[model samples]
Target chain A: MTASPTPTDAPPLPWTCPFCALLCDGVALARGETLELRGSDCPKARQALAQQPADTAAATPTIDGRAASLDEALDAAARLLAGATLPLFAGLATDVAGIRSLYALASARDAILDHLLGDAIMASVRPLQDRGVYYTTLAEVRTRADLIVCFGTRPAERYPEFFRRIAPGEPRRREIVFVGTDTDPAAAGPDTELEAVPFAGDAFDTLALLNALAADRALAAPPPGPLAGLAARLQAARYAVIVWEPGASGAQGALVGEAINRLVGTLNARTRAASLALGGSQGGYTANQVVTWLSGLPLRTGLFRDGLRHDPWALATARVLAGRNADLLLWVSSFDPSATPPAADLPTIILGHAAMPPVAGAPQVFIPVATPGIGAAGHLFRLDGGVVVPLVQARDDGLPTVAAIAGAIAQRLAAPASGAGS
Target chain B: MSAPAAVFELRLRALPRFRVDLAGVTPLALGALGEAEAGRVAIRHGNEALALGELFEIRRRPANAPALHFEGDLSRFDRLAWEMEDGEIRVDGPVGHYAAARLRGGLVAVAGDAGGFAACEMAGGELAVAGSVGDFAAAALPGSMDGMRGGTLVVRGDAGARFADRMRRGTAFVFGNAGDFFASRLVAGTIALGGRCGAHPGWAMRRGTLVFAGETPAVPATFVETGHDLRVIWTLLARDLARAGGPFTALPDRRVRRFAGDIAVDGKGEWLLPE
Candidate 1:
């Protein structure tokens, strides 16, 4: 199939936006010659719905820089992987099924596995590993937390509807405090008090001092003079929540997380408190949760014969290429249009978004894959790491999903070398 | 028939974010595999996947002992001997964070300084650092309720901030100075420091032993000085400390003045001062 054949008869289905980790499933989509999205005003969702597969020229898989049939392309990709002594499977940005199939293939080939946001995701994960994390779902924050503190991040920028959806109609309005410089006064619900504690220095020191001061520990220098009141507010609140984004926290981010963990621990000594770490965008949480459940390790894991070995730093696909470690690179990005395969000087195969532009002067294989929520039904985990949302098939984009393509490749790999399947 | 000792050496190339977890890649484990199969051992550096042979130049030789040798500066490498169960890991240079963290069993020796949280949360193992180490050495991992539950961490040089914070059960020996909040929130463990320590020793210690062989540290107000005889415990502990060598070689002969408190939390942890 060179191009996605348009389906004219399928009924309109409620769509799930895979552009972000929220997995907002309330979107209503109208499919036709052109797609239309409604019910959600998120710019990301609109952009995702507007993504159209490239023309026939771009949809066809290319091998050795030449357009080829799907069978020929799959065979070529399989052969490249079969010959590779060490293969790196990176950019795991597809749906749940896709990643599962990919993992099976990687296991069969004993390939190294990772995700595009593995580093960013690991920033949050490292803190979880080093010290433990105290987390509450968005729903709990809405109902329970009387105080909300955002540390070094503005949730509205990333989770656009965070403030509106979280504390919209609480009984006694939740008090909002921003530990960093940024603030959104309007996000504060009616009768809710909003305060900002400006801190633009190293987060490690700030958080550490805050924990000490809050715990009533005597320190020569405490979190700047302004934050002294923070401890009092925390003690007064029935339920307090501290929110932070590991990606935005400056150097010593993990230490900042440690400090937050300590702060929560100290608060729990007397009253109720928890932490809310915000950045789990781009299916990062889904991938991490899935991998953690399956292999008892998160992303950046190497499938060993004995067991899975997780190393957030060492098993990176980028590092593998730069260090000349892996002989083959398999990149998968089947979500957003802008999710393109990273350019690397290695034998590479890309199962990428249809809207991805062709790379210049690279002898890499490119196979355009279908968008999960838009073109096919799929499952994804939300940022909370607990909720799993379903994507209803809204339209027949005629393109193959990453799961299908990966499944095909895995089947081909398992088949006899001279089988008619190839 | 005994399996030959296979030396699995990892030489530093450049620092990567995702640490390499050599949990299952032990000398004993790899020694049984074929040369090619051993070379194909999977490892991750940052978000990249790599084979054992790709990052390090492998030279497997026959020996009687199983050990993993790390050459060159590994200050940026985290989790050097992560969760290691069996074998010996020898580092020639400074190691990074979480070295031998959650280690169940084995001997991890670093010839140079180690980064933060070295030997943290280790259940069973012997981690010896020839040089100073950063904060939280022999302490619990962040979020973990208990720090080093079991194992022995010997730091030849000074320790940084919050040394042995939240330790539950273990023996930590520091030959040099220690930073502030040394032995803070000690749940249960034995820490022997041969040098001066910063403020707030045993801040909220629930139960543990802090042996100071160097300058006298300020005792927290929560602790009450008691002229009691802990001769049996001290003598036995001093003997163990003496066996560790370095400044501890003379620890058994020194007279100890004991003060118990950390009454702020549970008031059970003790501080032993060399008289």
Candidate 2:
């Protein structure tokens, strides 16, 4: 990895901001006391960069709250895993390479795997598995969408750069509608029309009405006027894009996701329409994509002695911990320091961000590791799931990557014990 | 007089800290093995493979009936009688998840409550639970499209959420209340509920009959009331349900109001409410 040039030496280094799911590449970073964003004023990127200070002291590996060498820590973690009956690997917030090595380790240990954002990922995955989906990418929405519908959520609130990233290149007339939410002013443009339609009931009820009207099904009660109009507009548009955030959709989010797909399917029969789900941030998609490709199952799956078993609800991290099914927990969170492992009575091994604070418990192994975009070079899957963004290393923190730490532990487990040397 | 067949009884010696998987210890599977060989059967306790005799005390006795009996709380035991072909498997207490899943032919009777995904993907047989069941009972496995394809599941007590979701072909009778999203996305089946249900029952269902013999539910606007001139069809369905006894025995005597929809998916499923 090439070191970023000094600000006075040359222009800002071109970098991909891995702060959000967008993976914005049209940004430049200048090396200073901290990495500073030069091109974009995205608050999320600024905040993330500020959190990762360049001159910060590196962290060391520890076992049972006492400082230990990397080798000792690896051995301790391997022993815990070797004696475990059922191990759960959760808080998977790392890049592709990190997950690749971890998958091998998990396979050897017969561990259950789940992401920090497993619920959100399943909200989108379950619907696709149950029926199917008509989905769109960011590029398609920017170039082809004439009418965009923001369903139940305002993308700009969580994803700050969503509208700006998909800003149309040429001057063309477009309509933006926010159903069950207030219209976002940031989405307004000179050539774009904006409208906000209040939901007649809750999101579920409103979608049910829209689907019925769009399908031209007769209803005893009159439909909500604005919803009916929007339904007609969706039918008439050249290409419509429905935007939603599955993470914000609440507990029954899978049903909501399925409803959005149903609405998209209803419109596609008459006109062109597709949905754009805005989530999978913090390497959630990276871990999920890697695990799915390596094993035939998605996240929340277990590699058991019998075979691979994927139980989304039963094998959930919280459920597994509550039920005391797993004897050990291996938590990996290399992107964010705040993403700590859930409190459980079982022994834990953490491969986390370099700046992570000490976990308050006994029988724990804490090994601070490198962040993908900040301290190491890696690749991540974008929110849209179609594009893979190459993350450029901005600095060297003298920290090991999650891949290295996990690989080391796996190696220790695979190798037989050595005799004392003379 | 002819001698009676033997019955295999497994009594839990002690409660295990971790969940145990009893997938292959069904009556038909064990009946093929001698008592000594059956004791050597491998079952999963947490991550380790342990012999059946290590966890349970196995005993064989000559009886008039041939069946496999489990005594004690098997709530920590999962996949009981899984894919069982024939013979009877009786659990005196609650059983864990995937109980009798993919059951081809036989009877799995649980005297107590059951865990999630009970009778999932069942092809043929009967799973009768004396107590309530947890979520996704008779529902599809996480990603599979079909659930409880062919069988009869009779739950004597309340059922948890998403009961019979994505069911393709089967008949499920719940003699008590059910949680939300009842019969969701049901493809083809007959589900008869004895008590009240939670929100959004029969959401997105395609082709199935949801019979609510209890109080009328707050119906979704997408459903429209239809003519109730199907006395013959009701009689046939009610007679089959009555055979299960309990709350279903009085089902044929009640008149019903019919509503057709979940047309949100352009579905043809119906909800029958007793009038």
Candidate 3:
């Protein structure tokens, strides 16, 4: 791959930042004498684009800490995978194309595929599976929802563009209601009304009371004053949507989401209401969707002989590694440069971003891959599971795409044992 | 030449985890189309748009009839017979989430167990599961006001948590043990649990009849024992439950004690405990 030419006199180009699930596509990139990034200059996007090319020039395939040719690295990785009884293809932080190729490789090897955010995905998915949730897409939240009730975590810390994207347009005003946590009062428009329903006790108990309130049940001891009015406010709304993030809600924060979902269910009985989950950073939702479609199960599943068996607890990547159930590990992180292979006592192969720093003790093989929306163009699913935005190529760092690397590995795995005999 | 009964058979060749929304693809709707067109029916596999023929084998057998049959263990298949207006769909094996969801008019029978949210948000239909069922059966979908506005859901085996939640109008009879929060926040309906139940049965229910023929769990503080004699409704409901068959077969003759409260709410919901 060749880097796109940076004209000395051209205007800034609109680029989509692929670092987060928000897929904020309005970034302006100007490749002048010094690379300049403007627009939603989020800390993550700015940091990603401000790196000097010289620092990333050290990207090269390696075998056991020693520099090696691409063929030599692929050969070594294939040898390790072909010899292993059970392999784990994990640390999937890439675009749709990258994950699709990884799924193919995992299927050929009958390996267990898991994402970096497997636990977080399960936190939300478990509730949706056991107890259904009514969710809306980001677009729906932007245009239709009138009452936005944010539960627990603040959206700005993780997704800086969250408030900007969901801000209502002209002639309309939205009400921003925060529950569980205190937030900045100035995040919304001056015309927009903001309210906070702070409560004591855990998220589960608070939401349970809210559920009963929404159901019009009388509480033995009524909750705090602010909470007492929440039921009436929700009932009076024309269209209401509750928002929460499973990842930031503590260890069992997803339980809060489950409770909020039940409340939404109860509220919808009389009025129009829905729920929205905010955080899906690092391509977690995309990976979960891909895995579910191909395997008929979510993350933490094994490609057993019968079929893919989903056991979030048993098939967790960490647990599988700790139990020594997997003989080989294939870590793929194509977006974050600092995302290195986890310290495991097993043969490891890495398909990482070009700017990824070298670990003290390197893996058996390391192949630097192009970051989507930077060096390659691909599709990425948004957090709401409604939109699949395009990741346009801005500049190529002369690195192979994860799809090409994983595809090469899959082809080698499908070959006869004679190919491995040598 | 068109022969005997028309039976459309879809045998699962591979397990699909993503829910296949079988909402509009009924036998009557697809009977006019040829095998090729039927194969082109749209279904979602994860993020990809796939053809129904790519996943299931679609074939019309004997004659052109409005009856569909499925074979294989479809425990991963979701939303089967969803919102079907009029037809017959039979699953020879287990099914996944939202099986027969929003069903209007149909006869859907699963020979094996079913996943959560089965018969959810249904308007009218008859859904029978020969084996067990997961949570929220005959319950409203998330953010929907009414659950199973009109239908009949009969689960032969055990049911998990939050069964019949917010059911507005329907008749649900579970023959086995039910998990926590049974008939919780019920607006109006008839629920008969022939086996033991977990905690918080009839939590905050407004108006509904929950008949517990077996051991009943603890009622919430919001609920107060009314000790009312409901022999008239009990006799009629018991006979209907007996017709469904189960431990409730002898429901008519048993003496009952009543408690009405979710006083928290309308306090009109009735919980009949067999004495």
Residue-wise C-alpha lDDT for candidate 1, range A1-422, written one tens digit per residue: 12234454545456777777777776776666666676768776666666765342457888877888888888888877776656788888888888888888888877788888776677788778865878787788888888899887887777766776676454676788888755786466776888888762445435645665676755433346667787788877888999888767643366566668778888888998998777666667777787777777788887854456675655767666765666678988887657666667677888988787777644578788877776778888887778888887766666788888888888888888724221
Q: Best candidate per TM-score, number?
A: 2
A best-first ranking of the candidates according to their DockQ comes to 2, 1, 3
- Which 10 residues in a row give candidate 2 chain B its minimum summed lDDT? B1-10
TM-score (C-alpha, index-matched) for candidate 3? 0.63
DockQ of 1: 0.11
Candidate 3 lDDT by residue in tens digits, B1-275: 13234568888888764434464667666666677787898865432357878878988865645778888887766788888887788999998778888999879999999988899888898899999989888877534667778889989998987788889998998999998778877889899998998766776577998988777665554555766667887887888888987788888888887877666457788888877
* Candidate 2 per-residue lDDT over residues B21-134, each given as its tens digit: 999887756775677888999999887789999888899876655689999999999999889887789999999999989999889999999999999999899999999999
TM per candidate comes to: 0.68, 0.96, 0.63
After TM-score superposition, the amount by which residue A46's alpha carbon in candidate 3 deviates from its true location, in angstroms, is 1.8
Model 3: residue A327 alpha-carbon error in angstroms: 0.9
Where is model 1 more than 4 Å wrong at Cα?
Answer: A1-13, A30-34, A54-57, A170-172, A185-189, A221-225, A250-252, A360-363, A418-422, B1-275
Q: Per-residue lDDT for A158 in model 3?
A: 77
Candidate 1 docks at the CAPRI level of incorrect
The candidates' DockQ values read: 0.11, 0.72, 0.06
